[model samples]
Every structure is written in structure tokens, then in C-alpha cells.
Target: MFGKSLKVFGILLLCISFTGCAKARYAAPEPETRVVGGASRAEAFRFTPSGDQAWLSWEQKPTDEEYGSFILKIGRANFADGSPLPLDTAVGVEVVLWMPAMGHGSNPVALEKIDIGTYRVSEVFFTMPGDWEIRVRRTTEAYGVEETALAIRI
Candidate 1:
């Protein structure tokens, strides 16, 4: 009985030792952005055939001018790779309706941020219905300012 109890105690000590030495598991870090051609895009655009809704995600950075400090580890969901963007980052979106053939642009449409990395612009109906272009301007400190124009025939 004494020998059996000693063996059990030793096994318990061995298990405890192993548990203490186990390493913690953490999520892998994200990858860095690579620029190709003249422009590097940290944003993604998705337009549906319904012609009523659009989704955009762009990277933004705000720096402290006096201190010259940047918020570190701020992550924006790479719409291209399906990652999560930081919550505190500021992003501004604008929508402009342009008639390329007519050489005129329409009134500004309001954009709302639905989540951390998604913006929704609704009720984008063209008045004349020809070759209408939607120019989306995304402004952020990280990427400065970038504009994308999408053409649709209604």
C-alpha cells in the first residue's frame, strides 16, 4: 500500500511539472503591406448587382503632430485577405456621382460606417442613366488619400 501511494504521488508531481513548463499559444501576427506598380491598396470594394448597396474598407492612420508618434499595432481588416481592422482608427468616406460622357458630377451622397472595416452607401440612383461613375474617396493618415472610380451602366 505504501509503495502504491508513493507511485501515485510521483505521477501527480510529474503531471504538474509538465503543465507548468507548457508554452502559451498566441495568434500569429499579420503580414506587412506590399506596394505594387505606383499604388498600394489597403482597401477592398464590393458592389452587388442590386445597385443599392456598396461595401468599402480602407486603412486610416492618425498621428500626433507635436509628439510625432503613431499608434502602433493598429490593424485594419485587409478586405483582400479578410482580416480585422482596428476599432479606434478614423476613416472618412465620400461618394460622388459623375457622368463621364456628360462631364458633370451630381450631388454628394452620405456614407455611414457600419462596422470597423465596412462602409455602406445606399440609394445611389443615377438621374440620366448612362455611363455613371461612382468616385469613392477614402482618406486616412496611413495611406494618405486615395480615390477609386467605379463605372456602372444603368
Candidate 2:
């Protein structure tokens, strides 16, 4: 009877020691902009569609109107090798915000060009947010179309 009780206590002590090694920790989210991209990216921006390129940086523009509405800027576009794109390179950009779970998108987004390789995007409305994706696309005659997506929660 003493031997059986001693073996049981030894097993219980071993189980308690293992449990302490597997403690879980809570992590707080970062406030910086993060984008999901493939290996073919320049700096923090993700450029896609392969070959000849364009890019969208993961920098958020501050908005004055409301919390749901925001602004974005598309700039510093370059080649896959990090070389500057030509000054006359014709480019068209479009921004879309959508919730994939609900299968719906927000209002129209305005794309305004300030200068060559520089653009000001506004009117990004989040409506109601659970999880949202901001799809930024750039189209050109040379490279066809290249796009990058940023997933965010509001």
C-alpha cells in the first residue's frame, strides 16, 4: 500500500511541473501598418502581377472627417530592383475597401493625382467593420495591372 501511494504522488508531481512549462501569454497588437506580401516586394510595399512593376506603401494617411472615413497615399513606386519608374510612366490607381465575411463593400473612393508618381486617395469609408481588406491596384499599358492588399480591423 505504501509503494502504490508513493508511485501515485511521483506521477502527480511530474504532471504539475510540465503544466508550468506550457503557460500561455497574451499579446497586444501593434498600431503600425502591416501588409501581407510575397517575396517580390520593394521595402515595406508589395508589388505584384510579376515582371515590370508598381508598388503601394503600407503607410496610413490621417483623416479629419470621422473614424470610419480615412485617406491613403500611393507614392514611391519603383521597379522590382528598387529603381525609379520613369517620369512619363502612365499609371492608373484604384482603392477598394470591403468586408469579405459580409460580402459587401463601402462607398466610392476618390483617386487624385498630385504629380508624377504621387497620388492622394480619399473617401475610404469603413461603414461597419469586423474585418476589412483594402485592395490597392495600379494599372498600366506596359505592365498590365499590379495590386497589393492590406487587411485591417476597425
Candidate 3:
């Protein structure tokens, strides 16, 4: 009985010591958002700009029947300061790919509204290896229209 009591006391002391040595906790930094064309931005989308590819996972709202679509959750990351500005009040989004060096562009592709703000585009393939630009035009509720381009090289 005495041996059992000592073991229990030792365990209790060890647990108490661990509890007393608590480490400070720090919160993660909030993602940065900017107001552009009267819209709020969030790190709700992710893409590898260097690869000349884009994948967005926006908040799913009702799918736009006019623009039938699919979902591709690419994860989330904040957009770098300036360039490729994201609009909050975007009601319509379109993507176009152009190869400046080759002096040509891929076939026209339409982006379908899959979820609320989530959009999916088909046939965005780079046929040749060279400099490419993906231009995006967003129809905003307040600003009327906003455009940004993502440059990439292969």
C-alpha cells in the first residue's frame, strides 16, 4: 500500500509540474485584405503564379445556371501586395490565356460559376513552352469592371 501511494504521489507531482510549466500561445497572423472596386478580399484562394496556373476555392453560393461549373479546392493563401487584385463584389469572372512570345493565344474558355464566388475554367492549357499571361476580367457590383493579369513562364 505504501509503495502504491508513493507511485501515485510521484505521478501527481509530475503532472502538476507539467501543468505549472505552461508555454505562451500566439495567434496566427490574420490574412491581409484590400478594398478594390468596393469589394472585400480574403485569402480564400490559392494558386502557383510561377507555374502559370490558377486554382481558386471561393465561398460556395448558389451555382450560376447560366455559367454551369465544377469545384476545385486549391487551398488558401493571401495575394501578394498589389498585382492580381481580387474583387469582392464580382458577379461575373472570365479568364483568358495569351502567349506574347508566340504571338498567339489558347482557345477561348468560359469560367462557370460553381459556387457563390467560386469559379471553374476549362481548357486552360499551355501548348508551347514560353511566356504566358492569364488575364482575368471581373464584373463587379460597384466598380462595374476590374481586370488583372498573372504572368508566367515555362
Most accurate candidate by TM-score: 2
- For this target, which candidate reaches the highest lDDT against the unseen true structure? 2
Q: Write the per-residue lDDT of candidate 2 for residues 1-154, one digit (tens) a residue.
A: 9999999999999999998787456533322344332222332344444433334443343233442323334444454755545243446777788777799888877777766665556666677736777777777677677776666665
Off by over 4 Å in 3: 1-88
Q: Is candidate 1 or candidate 2 better by TM-score?
A: 2
Ranking by lDDT: 2, 3, 1
- For 8-84, candidate 3 gives per-residue lDDT tens digits of 99999999999778754654332233222222232232232222122432233212222222233222233564223
Summarize candidate 1's per-residue lDDT along 1-154 as a digit string, tens digits: 9999999999999999998886656632222222212232333333222112233322322112211111111233446865544443336656786878899985555456555545555434456546666676655556555555555454
lDDT against true structure, model 3: 0.48
- Clash count, one per candidate: 3, 0, 2
lDDT of each: 0.47, 0.57, 0.48
Greater-lDDT candidate between 1 and 2: 2
lDDT: worst 10-residue window of model 2: 35-44
Angstrom error of the Cα, residue 84, model 1: value is 9.3
